[model samples]
Target: MFTRIASALLVAGLLATTAPAAHAQTTAAKKAAAAKKATAAKKAAAARTAATKAAAAKAVAARAVTPKAPVAAPAPLTEAQASAGVKEALNKGIIKAVQFASEPDGFNLNDDIHIPTPPDLEIVKSTVGRLPGMGLVFTQLETQLNRAAEAAAPKAKDIFLNALANISITDALTLVTSGSTDAATQFLRRSTQSQLISAFHPDIEAAIDQVGAGRAYATVTDKYNKIPLMTPVNLSLADYTTQKAVDGLFILLANEEAKIRKNPAARTSDILKTVFGR
Candidate 1:
């Protein structure tokens, strides 16, 4: 009976030990499975993240490779406009010359410089002024005409300047490029002739009437016409006046041009600097 009891206790002890070993093995297997699943999930997440990053990088690269539209250039100024600029420069030169020429005594005192002389009657003025009762009247007329000319002279610049300002750059470009010495002058005459005639006519007619020198003028003109076969010679005072005004203006313009050519300061503005060039 005692032996039987001991064997039973030993069997119980063995069974208990075996059961603990089995529980430990099952726990270990469960832990390993969980670890594998977690690792797999982490790896999949990492792969997804890499793919997303690659896609983003590819999108950025594509954007960088895309080309932008080219910017357009500004349009150039037209020929007429450029010519107009040239005309403006020329007119400025004229203004400068006239201002320079007009001194205290001005045209009257400067007989050697015939620019101050009234239109088409220099001989008649000097001759008639020397005559009998005509002397004072002729001198008065001379003075009046000279005064009128000076007064009217300044107005020409305004008209000429306006014409020049309107002149197209294209006209200026063509004129300069054409290589004509008198191209600028010719252009001014063509553009402003009619306007100049209209502006100067009334003043000249009034001047002729003031001098009482009209009879003397008619006498001189008749004598010249009667000389030989001089046609009828119905010359308009307007023509003579316009011509004189234009001549004086041109003379002054040339002077101004000389200034620009010689003195650096005379090239006052930026346009002058560019046009004249250093």
Candidate 2:
């Protein structure tokens, strides 16, 4: 009976000791689980924060690469302004051309526009030029022809003005903003070359007759024809001189027109300063 009592006491002591140890192990397990869960939650929050910061940085980078809107352009030129500007440019250029052409050396000295001896008179000129005293006679004929044309240049002003007055608003606009350096000259050329030719031909004939160029040409041709084996030539001196004279005037006009297109200082008129400067 004593042995049975001792064994029961020993069993009870072992059970109490084991129960406290089991409880301690269970509490330790619960604390480890809680700490691991908290660490996982912290890591998840850090990952979410990093992802949010990266997303924010990407948005900022996108904004930096975007282009800004452009500034607005100024208003268009009014129709009246365009018309006035075109007329003003044309009138200025034409006036300058007429004034220059009216000068003594206008066509005679300006080699670019100087009328050569009538091409038909080539053989006649060469033949006569060989004659001792007639060496400069052909050159004199060319000068006399140019002088006649110079005398006829002022007449173009009135004809050009008349033509400009006839130009429509659309035509005026086309000339003003055409971006062409020769716009004014080309416009005048189209409007006036043929008309000026007609107006100039009779005057050229009278002027050449008055200036004695016709006599000079006759002298040269007569002398050449008398020289054996040379063919006779008859060309319209009036036609050649008149065309060349008009061409010279337009060449000068084109120069003036270019100044308006390229040089701010050349835009002297109020309308020119306003329209082209902008």
Candidate 3:
């Protein structure tokens, strides 16, 4: 009976010890699993935050690269406005041109408009230039021809203004809308060329006589005629000077017209600023 009692006590003691050890192992395992789950959740949250930041950065970059829209063009002008503007431009241009051309050295110093030895008198110049003291005669004649043109330049202003005053509305509109910088000047030339020649001839002739250009030309021709086998050159100095002076006047007018058309500062009047500022 005693042996049976001792064996039962030993078996009970072993059961109690094993139960406590198993409970400790189970608690440890639950703590480790909870720590690993928390770590995994923190990693997922960090990844989400990084993704959101990358998406926001990409959006900002896209916005930075986009282009802005262009500005709209100015509105067009009315018919009356166009006509008035064109006439004003022409008027201003002619005034400046005449003033500039009438100034001293206007034609003489300007190679573009300076009258050269007449084509009709080239032979006379070439032959007579070889002679002593005769070269001065041709030089003096050339200078005097430019002087005549300069003297005749002032006569063009009245004629040009009259033409401007009489310019038809249709013509004015055509010039304004033609997209050409010198359209008005060209129109003035086409319409007033004949009138200009007629008006300038008398003044050019008188200027030539006054400036001694006629005498110098006479001297040159006399020398050429005296030379053996040279063709006698007889050109009307007034006619040639009138043509060249008119042409030079138109050139200056055209230059002024271009400036008014293309440059904002050249638009002197309110009408010109309104019409061409567009």
Candidate 4:
């Protein structure tokens, strides 16, 4: 009976020890599971946060990529505005020098502008002296023709100013750069020829009548036309005045070009400032 009691006590002690070890292992497994759950929760939160940021960034980029509307163009210049621009260039001494130089005195005084009496007229002048009273008639008629041209000088300025007003800024720039002194004159002839012809025709006719150039021109033309087989040349005072007006304009424009190259006053306008200023 005592042996039996000893074995039973030993068995009870073994059971107590085994119970504590098993309890310790169970506690450790539970703690590990809880830790794994916490780690997963943290990872899931970080992934959500990263995804949200990516979506926000994508939205901002899309907004930035949107295109804006285009701007409108400016209006074109009006006729009045264009005219004013041309006139501004003219009002400055730039083109004025040309006008002054294109007058009767401008050409008559400058050896360059003279329309030489036809080489044939020299024979007429020499023969007139041998023919007594014919000398005075020839002299009077020649003098009168020249006087008529002098009388017509003032009209040229009027024609030039009118032509200048019509000059386009595009044409003006072309004239200022690549054009000769006669560029402006050529432009005027092309642009203002019809208008000037209209404006000067009546005035030229009246001047011819007043100067008595009509009779002299007719007599000379008649005498020349009567020469057998020669091209019947009927020269009119009006026609001469028209040709003179064109010649005078070029002479004046050349003078203007000279002034512009030398004088500061010629480049006084705003357009000139832009075009000519350094």
Highest TM-score scorer: 3
TM-score of each: 0.50, 0.72, 0.76, 0.51
Q: Could you give candidate 2's per-residue lDDT for residues 1-278 as a string of tens digits? A: 99999999999999999999999999999999999999999999999999999999999999999887897875787778888887788788889889989999888888777788887887676667888868677878988999999999999999988877777788777777887889867877887899999999999999999998999988887887787776667778899899988899899988988898899999988889888887
Model 1 weakest 10-residue run by lDDT: 110-119
Candidate 4, residues 124-148, lDDT tens digits: the string is 4454345545556565555554444
Which of the two candidates, 1 or 4, achieves a greater lDDT against the reference? Answer: 1
Count of backbone clashes, every candidate in sequence? 17, 0, 0, 1
Residue 28 in model 3: shift from native, Å? 30
lDDT of 1 at 267: 69
List the pairs of residues colliding in candidate 2. none
Candidate 2's error at 259, in angstroms? 0.6
Global CA lDDT computed for model 2: 0.86
lDDT of each: 0.63, 0.86, 0.90, 0.60
Pairing residues by index, what is the TM-score of model 4? 0.51
| Candidate 3 residue lDDT tens string, 148-177 | 999889988899999999888888878887
lDDT of 1 by residue, 205-247 (tens): 6755664445544655555456455444454554565456556
Sorted on lDDT, best first, the list reads: 3, 2, 1, 4
Better of 2 and 3 by lDDT: 3
